[model samples]
Target: MPKKSLLMIGVFLLATTIWAALPRVSNPSPDYQTQPTNDGSHVEKIRAVWPGPNPEDRVRARVVMSGEDIIFEDGPTSQVMNTHSIRKSLLSLIYGIAIDQGLIDLEATLQELGIDENIPLTNQEKSATVRNLLMYRSGIYLPAAGEHDSQITDRPAREEHEPGEYFFANNFDANALGTIFIQETGYELGPFMEEFLATPLGLQDFDANNVIMGDPWFWPSQDTRHLQYYVYMSARDLARIGAMVAQDGQWGGRKVIPKDWIELITAPHSDLEESHVPNHLYSHFGFQWWFQEETGTVWANGYGEHFLMVDPTHDLVLVERNFSGNSLLSTARWLSSGNKFSGSLWELIDTHAMLVKISDS
Candidate 1:
């Protein structure tokens, strides 16, 4: 065989092996229910409120669905974008499944799970249970991958609070939960997500290959023991997950996530008034989800203003995404433009107002 031909054959073999290793759903569910056509009035109502001034240029995609009908959708809802910290919420969903199957014990301490970091966790810190991490009350203050400067600055001092005594939105807890999930389940986050969550929910644009784990752009040289689990998902697909959560984890007449687990995750576990979270709209903290007690809303929030909001009160699911780009250079460029989408609870409120107005009319 010619040298060039041999090289091409070797490359082909490698690619085939890699492709074969990727996870696939043995039987993917049917596509999610969407309205045959978008309601024009609903579209106009949502559009009038969205991209409101600041978020206009940065809002990349959005999907608003009520029950089984997609009321409004805009931008490339199918385009995959880095979901930032929303990966934590996805991990929470997976945890619910794992816990139900006896793969993980919520009350198990970090010491019991053999969870540690490069800097080493104190014996007291190791006493924090898996449940504590889920509630962002782990009280482990070590630097974590994907944390913003504000989080680092505001992080409680070592031993400032005992396990489960305080609630600080620390990425360390979120990232460590990812590590625990992989350890307990013997499956990577991506494949587990595909087999357990995405397949069950019939997500339209989920690709296990796109799910990655690494340091955040600003914290590239951080600890390697527990990296951030970054998921790339489309707004439309996220809406499906939100809808499932809204319905108490049932999808297509099948119970995907346990109803009790869903309730536990969305129910407030942290002190509402004492938590150090920057957002006033987040009235309480659930397992890994954010809660607005007044409106009965649960949401998964990510950096760059990405949100997956499930408002069971109104039977509404809204997903918003701001493309931070895929590569470091592209992400840097996007950040340099000074157009990152902002607001968390306020954005949800604005969107919900539109829904309310449309409903009244």
Candidate 2:
């Protein structure tokens, strides 16, 4: 054999060995046998329109439900992936329960709650109430864990507005809510969610142990005062959450979340003009939820295309998950790209269009 050919063969063998040695995380095979009745036509229509033409909008799983019946499901619906900012909406639900139990007071001021930060909060900033945090109107701007660069850049100056006087999609408010919940309720977020929210809704793929405190892979050195409480949930499990909300917080005839709490959280607290969300489709902001009153729909959106949409008018719930894979290479690429690797606006628009069509049918 020629020397060049032998060298090429040796190089190929070495590359193959290295590739085989790399650790891989695999999504569990979907259990098709136990999957609910799926409408083939609906699934096909969704596939044709959703995720759009963006290469970054890699949708990993989707599940659509009408009432208690799952009408469509695709990909690994059982695989638990990061829920990202949807954790905020989950926290809202937990707050509802805590408030009902008299464990948390919405009107309690941050000063009274002892919510001090590393940089120190102003007296005016400390006057913000728990309800203000839930509405993202806390008006305290500080570096927060799990925040994107755009969010940080767009954040209003510290003490720009008094508490409850303005609206901004602030991660500081959400993360602080996590702190307040733990302090007032004396229950860690994960176990409390698993008990009060997950188990009640019959979530099949939720594990309290898997809940993360911060994005260790990306923002490892974020402020320790208020770390983001990240939740991991399967598409199917998220669908269950959407279903309960769609049913006015009722799950199988039992009131899982208080009806008044549901009504209050879904009500439009901040108008589009005030909230300044980039998406025109969402007309208002509720307590950690986006509201489209025209369609009578509420949404919980997370980074990288994770969504939980509830349409009470049609009794429909839709969940979409985009897992960017857990490989070190993927994480490295995400970090290298300034942590801007997220789902496209076009994809979200397309998803909304598809949902409208499916609901109409």
Candidate 3:
């Protein structure tokens, strides 16, 4: 091609890309309002803070909520970040939708699918159920052999649990699906999710480019953009999700997820502490979604420190974007310390809300 032609083509593509990147000026759900709907000018931003003793380890993050901007030199609001295991939250939502659509039967046993303890699970491990898998209560333990077969299973980003616990993580990815098949399972997790969940939810952004465009467009080596891969989401997108879930899987009354099914999934299935939540809060977990006791609040958390909290009772959604993979354990140790990572993020919101309420009064 001639140099002039190439240059014109490049400029045209750049302009198209920039135009496509702009947020759509469409109406939000009538049930929910954008924080700064018009003007788009006073949008709040939060900053990520080190929040620890390690000065170099601190990451400044920006936070954006219902329309208010809270910027922390220490934190951030709109910067897109990976949603580690929080991806599981979205996964469960997708799975629930599939089941609601009659595409999957939660009660179905793996044995019925010819998934008997074969290559993947031994005789002792075949008792797992799809519900059990979603609940992280499966019988299969992290495969031994020292993660030698790590990239062989359909594990999530990272799961911290005991042996015989249906646990898996995206880290190191010993459970990479290519190596391990979903034997002794009712339905193949990957193909099923790709067809039912990813295809339904707006996550087409993640899978579409890869599936349609090979190699350079999609990283064939890692398939890193896969759903199991930490998803990159924006604050507004996350809020939209929160709003969707709040409406019981209905987007503008279109029945995105079966209404009855959404209620079933959000309802308390097990105590959260039993699943590793805190005692002070009546944190409970169901399927993949988590719940709070008095707060009736639930949240989805991602690694590298991200939280998407929804308080339906208050019609409030709070999002905190941070990086906590390095200091995860440290946050646990210094949780009592000022601004330790754990749930301090919530306290920050409560503090702000209280101030707002007082101002209103």
Candidate 4:
């Protein structure tokens, strides 16, 4: 054989050997699964800090990437935990679908939707529209259905700012959005989510049993408009949701959500630093997703450090959850206060830097 041909054959053999040495990932769900590689170095930094010194940081967490890569996971990734505000992001996806189908209108005012309460709303509050709620700019502070007392206590006064003029991470927005979905579709959130999202995404562990509905006692009004609900899901399932968003609503080659709607929701609408958010690495809020300005990534965040982030630039989905199920009150208090915990601030900054480094590496 010619010398050049022999050299080319040797190169091919070497490449094949290297490829064969790489690990393979299995996927029982529609999301792609790829084996962890040197790409997990950044994730290792996260794992090293897991169950950190603080009581608050000593919690469960799981991380996954696009292609369903098990980047870094600790504790039980399959354990269903209260998603808290992370539920809002899932709710946002439902809203996008509802709007795309013309089942709900973003411009529909609370009054037009017949979303009234036993306690009369100020005209400004009444003027709040679905769009305002999605933006967290409703400025309407009527007690939320599923919110705990701590959340309610933290809320601003009713109609504290004109509609479209303020941003507060109030549960009322999500609950009200839930009400709109039911009123318009004649289907409850659990069933609807299971059918449209969970089922389609091939979620491994989601069911009606995991659903937490609005507590009548916690609500400000008897009206269903004040009703709210939340879903508890596993980290892997949340990562699937993140992957779907990262892919612009496409999952397994299917258009699960409209691209335009995804763009609209992920686009920055409110600046959180301007809103006086403390220790906030991310500065902007999209529809329900939070935008990390530094990384150009968007995430669904919850109390207790539950997060599912999507970096479209790298086609990556990362998730971490601190299961507050065992210590709800303590966790809630810590999260609501926005205080630093277990070197989280430093770890978060380091993780972001590491991801960038790894991606560039």
Candidate 5:
């Protein structure tokens, strides 16, 4: 074969292989559950919120559903960005996995875990065990440890006692929870990730570790997908993950994540509605995962209104990547205060003009 012809054929085959894995456009309907697709319009003002001022920016937005990603960006079959604390939520997958394997007890107390330190944590914080931390109720005084709020402009930790300062303080430091996990459990992060979650999921091109060198160093990758590159992938893969959970952790009829582990990971450990906007009703956290609490929506969100949301009730998975949004925490607070989509995860994402996804692909 001519060298140029051979190259063309190789390209065609690669494209075909990627096409098979890429998502297909989903037919929509008013009813997507117990019936058919509830075709939602992509004509919202949301585009103003996608990351990157122009499509040329390294940032991209996406949306996936039912094993399809109708929203896409750039020219690659996969990409990357930063999911931030969203990584914490993914950590729950392992936590639940450990519990399901009888490596840890869900009901274990803090003292049982030997975590009650001399720190002045409140009774709520001290009594909190691994479960409370999963639920974000360890009551640990974050600002006390030097957390700072971001939007205050000139605000400093040594400034004043902000109303919600302790929890949301921008404090400019790694929350230490990541390192705490490895320290408490004696499990190395990278090796365990390869062993427990990544390998079983058939996921490569990712790394989860403390890639820093400071008091609270060890930053996880901003690329959440495809090996810490903001978890870059087609929406079909995201839906596949959700569908796996919806199907009780079964992937092509194989048990990837333990069944009991899925249930525990998705189940709530705290009050999600603690923050809501537009509608005050809410679903919150189940360990690191986000749940509607009311609608049984499980999610892991990022800096941009980047979301991987699943409505287990209706077998729906909706992902939104906005340029900037304050996320669930601030968004709900801003909304309850009777405002617009103020301080939302979507808004935070929109600010950077990065990537977001939503799909019925």
Candidate 6:
């Protein structure tokens, strides 16, 4: 055979090997207890607030909690799907654990981490720290997978705010965090998530096999690149995470993460910057988690109305998964267009408000 044919054969075998290794649900349909008696009034309220004539058209899954138990749930709680940026919240969880294990130093600078690109980082950008990335204040301004172009356009000139003075919800921040994780620990995101998080939380659906890089094309062709990644988790497992957060990193009487770290990350760090996302009720961010002051609810929000909300005051954890109006690629383009999204903008607002009412009830 010609050398080129041999090369093609090698490539085909490599692709097939990787595909075989990817995680699949051995038991996709498991016996999940459904709480028919759990108060669904809040879900009904959300249905009323949603735009579509039929609520089922908008919401794909929901999980409501009272303390550690699932009080109510409707829709496809067992169905696994991409929750978009909610993966950031999981990254945040990993960060807390990483920090506690002394694998990462929040105070460490980019220069110290040896973090640099082929495109040279300005001196000011090099001065950023892990904390700055967590706060979305690095101001490094690299093109990230899920970021809107308008955000890039609106961003201050390079080095405008030093490291911590400005706040923008750029995918670069999260991607850089992923890079830092691998650099510090020598583990890719998937395995790290499985060993440290899924195992500890007793999650039924999450594992290294199911996790995939969030933006495969962002740093494509770069041999030394560390790509950002995301996880596909079911509503029930998402609630497990929420319940853990509500319990200050404890699950089933075990301390899954340091309680102090949980407090530090969920506490308000900076006010959210203005964006095309119109109906966000959150005012501040903490370690990638959003903080709503009026309701004392800390949440992990994703594109297209994915939410995992924790209200400690009422011992409630809620997870909502709804249809993304467009495909991920199309949604990325829509966001880049600088036009506001109309269809699902209100879901976050309505969900938060309803959670408050649920707690009050």
With candidate 2 superimposed using the best TM-score fit, by how many Å does residue 210's alpha carbon deviate from the native?
1.9
Per-model TM-score versus the true fold: 0.85, 0.82, 0.56, 0.76, 0.55, 0.77
* lDDT of each residue in 44-112, candidate 1, tens digit only: 767777754354576477888887568888888877788888988988998999999999999999999
- CA lDDT of each prediction against the hidden true structure: 0.80, 0.78, 0.46, 0.71, 0.44, 0.72
Writing each residue's lDDT as its tens digit, candidate 4 over 122-238 gives 788989999999998888877655566545666777766898998877777778788788899887887777777777777876775466566411335435456666577877778
Candidate 6 matches the true fold with a TM-score of 0.77
- Candidate 2 residue-wise lDDT, 235-255, digit = tens: 898888888888889988998
lDDT of prediction 4: 0.71
What is the number of backbone collisions in each predicted candidate, taken in the order shown?
0, 0, 49, 2, 69, 1
Per-residue C-alpha lDDT of model 5 across residues 105-141, encoded as one tens digit per residue: 6555555555533343344444545555565544343
**lDDT, model 1:** 0.80
lDDT of 6 at 266: 94
lDDT per residue (tens digit) for residues 7-59 in model 6: 99999998866654443322243233222234554556655554342432443
lDDT of 3 at 152: 42
lDDT order of candidates, top first: 1, 2, 6, 4, 3, 5
Please give, for residues 100-177, the per-residue lDDT of candidate 3 as tens digits: 556666655444444432235444444455666566565454332222233245443223332236333222222222
TM-score of 4: 0.76
How big is the RMSD of model 6? 6.4
Which segments of model 1 are wrong by more than 4 Å? 1-41, 51-56, 216-220, 342-348, 357-361
Show pairs that collide, candidate 1: none
Which candidate has the highest lDDT of all? 1
Which run of 10 residues does model 5 get worst, by summed lDDT? 27-36
